[model samples]
Target chain A: MADREWSTVDVEDIAALTAVYGGNPARWPADRRAAAVRALAMDGAAHELVVNEARLDALLSMVAEPEISAARVDSVVAGALARLDAVTAPAAAKAAPHKLDTFLPSPFDLVRTALSWLSVRAPQAGWLAGATVAGILVGVMTMPSATLSGAETTTAQAGTAVETAQADVTDMPSLLFTSYTVETHAR
Target chain B: MDESVQPQPRVGTASASAAAPYAGNPAGTLMGLGPEPGDDALLARIAQGDRQAFALLAARHAPKAMKLAQRVLGNAADADEVVQEAMLRVWTGAKNWIPDGRARFSTWLHRVVVNLCVDRRRRPAFAGLDGIPEPPDPTPSAVNVMARQQTAKLVSQALAELPERQRLAVTLCYYEERSAADAAQILSLSVSAVESLLARARRALRARLSGVVQDTGEV
Candidate 1:
């Protein structure tokens, strides 16, 4: 079957082709490129799209490719080598594990790792310490007074109840026993 | 090119016998390989921990990688960092690389560079000025250099304002001169989708830079 004729190519397809492939029809898909070229020649809107896209392409072309400096290349390659070494070193060490090392790390090992990390990252440790102190200070300052006041009030209430009990004992029991004894003697 | 003479890094012993073929160049050597080695072949050697092959691959591809990075990242230092990191990944992952024949090594590498650049752009650590470097002039004419710098600044600003996908499409298609098909692979988009992206990007760029760049039609 023959390829679709130029008259069948729509403006939207032409515009999209222009956008993706730039203003050049030769660079468009081989199947539709012939029809697109014909359409560009016939349709004013399609021509306008190509012209506008060409202007943008011109601006894009003005943006030149930056030169990669030799120093930069060296630096990047060095960094890559260093990274490769760093990655392989651990694997190598793991392959030839120490006789004393266990499959699971001991507490001492964990502590040593933590200490090493802290030594290497002292700033992070400082930040953590500062955060902990700040949290403690904030907690202390913001604590509600109701708990302390409630404890003090309970202590005072207990003391008053004890004194009241002592006063009642002193005022009542001896008189009741004396009255009983006098009644028995009169009988 | 015997198996006993190829240069190997001193760190790893897994592929020691495999590193004997290309021993002349060491890591970080930027000298040309004279003839281009097939990417697959170099990758095969790289999988064997051949540093010379890696060096050759870097020399072959670094300039293009840097160009793509610089365009996407818009800063020399950031571009360098992203490329370096991508290259590092390429190094560490080469042993596991299975060439499925679906994409070329360059395409895969381009994707790596693109992803890293995009991630860097999103990171808070992207503190450098987000603008393309000014074109260097050998003669150092003050007025011409200034005008070019201003134009680059405007273009960079316009590019920065674009949506991430659109910016990527423009960088791959226009700046890097990649075909729509290859760019789609790098962007993980369909060919038509890349076209649509480029169309929208060009429209946006045209609108943003209407009066800035003189459309001489000569370019």
Candidate 2:
């Protein structure tokens, strides 16, 4: 095999041959081929030869096969973007500066502001008068019912009267029993 | 090879170079389309809450990532999943993407995709070429269909048989046309290590493709 009048093969030759047989031979001029052959000869067994061949075929197949559909590429990118969007959504949401809703005053603050306005715009007596009226309204709404109170007092008095009547009856019975016993003993 | 060539943060060119739709202008590459700024800048803008910039970054790099994923996993569907996951990682990390100016953003992106692909390729479902999708056979057009299919099958089979490192090394060099040094950086291997790996891979590939590569004209 060594005797076959070897024109030195090199990595460049492999590359040129790769270009040539891969169906783009025009890219490798003879000089380029010669240079490649020289490189391949010098660099033989240095890289994965079979794998390179396979890769060359794959590359050729890629070129031979029409460019991958643009739609395919679009879909892939769109899909990736969507995924990224989903993954980053929380972080993005958090990173945004506080919104208008965040700046709105609380209920307490609103009430305080209203009181301040009333104090400054109205006469001091008028503001105090309004506060007193508000306080009276709250007190009236929370007041106990007069009917309920009267009913409770009546029930207590009735209970005491009933107990007094029962005590009188119990004393009469005891007094009668004692008098009968003493009179019988004397007879 | 210059030591002064600061590592330019070699980001993946994925979302930044999206290919334009066929009906559109010639302006876009596969992932490098639309309004997304370059990767490093987009990363900066994204950190600053720029949704448009983030979208652009995703558009530019996803295609290349998908393609690399497909090669590693041997199935388009799985590759798609891997790319999606890889981009999700990029989105999360963008806030910290302080550019060191040593490598391109695309290069960094390439590494990310490669790592994801490698991880996914190790799964049981990706065991062999059996799961890889083959091109649909067209009506026989005197195209030597059998021969081409056989050649393609042999090539893919041989590729599948290479050690993962060798396979990746060859892929970056021959398929992607990356320089050895670039491949080394992507694989995180030293240049000499890549060279050695390539040497072994090429030898193995030569043995496997001897008959096919020879007869098919210089493959």
Candidate 3:
């Protein structure tokens, strides 16, 4: 039906259409568009009403769009970033830069390093690992009681075993736990 | 397109231009010209105070944000100031953002610009349409051309006379080429509310401008 000119609109309809859509047929409601065009062409009063609307459309069209300048984009971004620096500067001061290679190795890197170390010192690593297991088992299973009144000789041997175990196992625990415990306790 | 006719920061021509896709760029929705989808990462970078990330986000949205803001405030410098503050908020306030998918970055961006415009608009002295001057000169081409340039102030003043919501609705739906749904999202109103505001606004502006834009009989 919109393909043909339809005389469905009177001047009032023209008034209503123009009020909402202005004079631009391109902007008119699609269903009533052909009717509005026909009214404008055939009726003088309808033409008058639409022309008034069309005039406003033309006037409104005279207002220009703001230019989207690249310079504005750069300025806005720079402004925001600067403000962000101002905001976060205090907290950012606590951490050393992430670029510092000497600060710490990742866990995977640490493990790889240990593996390489052990390969170069295989005899020492074997001795250390075996001694660590032995010390742990001995500590759990038997203790040198500060006093074993009836068994002085056995107590003496137990004391020797405990001393040996404690000496051998200190390396692993201190390496793993000292830094962690120090920081935890410091906090 | 007319070099002879320089327009101020007005709503109507923006709408006319917006009635077509912006600059004939098929991909140009308000957001289309900005960063593509997945601003969550961008916001995360912003949250971490990554300046480059913030810059990336700003480049995508600032131009459109500026246009919307200037239209609302009716001044380019004021709009620039508002968008500056808005972008600053995006920077400083990004840490608080949850980056939830519930709202697009543009939605928040629009809200920020509109809210700033509303705040700035509160201080200005706006008048009603009671004393607008007569329409454009009815003479031929030369007078029309001069009228187009001269009437710019009256046109802006006439637009400023409408209720803020009416003005915003017209700008959003017409000049920005935002759909009712999109306008609704930006303004946080129902789609029907946006449609009604637009309808009322068109009529009010028609009466206000007083046909300063002459008819060429194309309608």
Best of the candidates, DockQ? 1
Per DockQ, what order, best first? 1, 3, 2
Second chain TM-score per prediction? 0.74, 0.76, 0.69
lDDT (Cα, tens digit) per residue for candidate 2, span B1-219 = 321222212223332334232214333221243332355766766665544555556555555666666776667677767766776676677776767877766677779888888877666664456465667667677368766667776777887899999889867765665666677789998866776776677667667777865667745
Model 3 C-alpha lDDT versus the unseen true structure: 0.63
Fnat (0 to 1) per candidate: 0.34, 0.20, 0.36
lDDT digits (tens) for residues B1-219 of candidate 1: 122123323212212222223355443232353333466677766776667667556655666787889888778888888887887777767766776766577788889999999888787863555443536666756767677666766777888899999999888877776777889899999887888888788778878887684533332
Ranking under lDDT, best-scoring first?
Answer: 1, 3, 2
Model 3 bad stretches (over 4 Å): A1-55, A88-187, B1-38, B95-102, B124-144, B211-219
**Which tens-of-lDDT digit does each residue in A1-187 have in candidate 3?**
1244555888887876666556777766567788778878999999988776666666677677777565655555556555655654322533535557667788768756765677578968856765775765565445432222223335556455444444444444343433343333233
On residues A1-187, what C-alpha lDDT tens digit does candidate 2 reach at each position?
1123335655544643452233232322344445444464456452344245545545335322212343455566667555654665535755676679889999768867777777778869558866865765565455332222222335555455444433433333333443433333333
**Location of the lowest summed lDDT over 10 successive residues in candidate 1 chain A:** A144-153
How would you encode candidate 3's per-residue C-alpha lDDT over B50-82 as one tens digit per residue?
Answer: 554455556566777898997887666677778
| Highest lDDT scorer | 1
